[model samples]
Target: MVSITISAAKRTSLAKDLPATLNFPDKTVDTLTVSDVKSAFAAKYPQFYPSRQKISLKGDNKLLADEATLASVGLTDGAELAVKDLGAQISWTTVFVIEYIGPLVVHPLMYHFPSVFYRTTVEHSLLQKYVYAMVMLHFLKREYESLFVHRYSHGTMPFAYVFRNSFHYHVLGGVALAYAAYSPTYANTSSYIVGTIRDDPKFLMGGALVWLWAEVSNLKTHVTLRDLRPAGTKTRAIPYGYGFNKITCPNYFFEIVGWLVVCVMTGSYAAWFFLITGTYMMALWAMKKHRNYKKEFGKAYPKRNIMIPFIW
Candidate 1:
């Protein structure tokens, strides 16, 4: 009898075995079968080819050998064959959801819940819950750099340096806002009614406007503006062709104004603290980016001030 050889395709789970070709001597086996191959793998490596192993044979592009048919091939001992592991591949989509999508999308949406409670409650538990939610959102925000923004982008100074400075102010100010909104310490001690909230409609409207404007701007600047820079191209050199450069970082401008509105509406010292800190940090970062753009593009860059276009 002549030698029969078996081979498996490369770059698959089976490819780890070098030169997949196996030889069958003249008289040991009648014919190769899927069960015989699976049994060989099981006897050699039980954990990898457990009883659950599924093996099928195909010839002339047609399937062959149910369990019963496999048992009937009747090949002799030491008959050589190839086996492939058909276990499911790792789910990259699940990984993407956990690593990138969940924190950026899911967590923020859930964290905004404090304001909702503050809207409904005049009770102590409600006040405590609002503060607790704010604290949770604050801690959660530390992860934002890793998840929301790109890892690296060149500017005059390190992005982390600028971001961390701003982040510190942002969180502190936010904590103050939450404390002022829920805590009555300032309200009890304040000399002027203007310094403490007393359920004024104008302040509430301003706060709503600020918060709503920020949300809209966030969607536009981060999501909708859609800078189509090619892969590996430096984004700093790109002008704000979306036209927002008319007033640099209109999104950030709204963010500052929103916190101010919150401060007035809540009559909370904390809100003012946050507004001051967040705006200062953002102003620094925006100025750096603006300068970098002008330097990179020269006269081609639009004529615009750092924060306000015509006035400041």
Candidate 2:
């Protein structure tokens, strides 16, 4: 058996209550994993659950992987480690449900109860009806994927992020887009008149085709990612196959395409705003993931654009 020393970082509020040094009594350098250390720490300090702890070597900035054996990471009999509190945590599933359910519910409410959102109500146009169906279908697919298809590496995220995410999906993407598409002003617009853009069969059919393709392609990309890490494990592997070949985040690319289709179909400034903001956020995420893949896999990682196929 080996004794490993763990010290809590001073940045956390719980640091005062944490012991200056914690010794693992039942673990050996070769046999123990970072996850085992976190479990032991949680047993001693209940507030610092494994999900809320970030552990690393004392002088190293890189976090230790839970699945990596201590020996593999160069930890020995007298090695020292640092632990940081990740603050309050909420389940990833819970956060996703909260974020997506808002758009699902809010959009329908605005579409069906126009009086609540606007002073005057107009008869729903065929274009508005098509947009409504697409919106519901898109969000429902998201809910299904979040619940069943996507497998998260980390079980929880910072609780503070829930509100920010919800506001984006609920208020902006849902309510704002719904109002812009279904409002009386939308019905009165010349482009949406009975013989104009909205009435053109080609425009409606083309938009629907693109939206459908994007949605299906996005689902495929997500499934590709989900299959990379087997169920009930946090292990990550460099992804390959369709969509992965050309873009680091084809899921984001397809998602942006789906939203762009909606924006063009609705001709709503609000929809454009949603698409732009969402694309920017997804781009940031794609760039970060692309860099991480390069760092983690080095030369073994394939070359790919962050999101767009070859243009980016």
Give the RMSD in angstroms, all C-alphas superposed, for model 1: 17.3
Residue lDDT tens for model 2, 83-193: 988889998988998999987888888888888888766777777877888889999999999999999988899999999989889988887887788887656444455
Ten residues in sequence with the least summed lDDT for candidate 2? 14-23
Expressed as tens digits, the lDDT of each residue in 225-290 for candidate 1 is 334343334445453643376765665675566555555544456566666766878889889877
User: Who wins the lDDT comparison?
Assistant: 2
Measured by TM-score, the strongest candidate is 2
RMSD per model, one decimal: 17.3, 2.4
lDDT of each: 0.45, 0.85
Worst lDDT run of 10 residues, candidate 1, spans: 150-159
TM-score (all chains, Cα) for each model:
0.45, 0.90
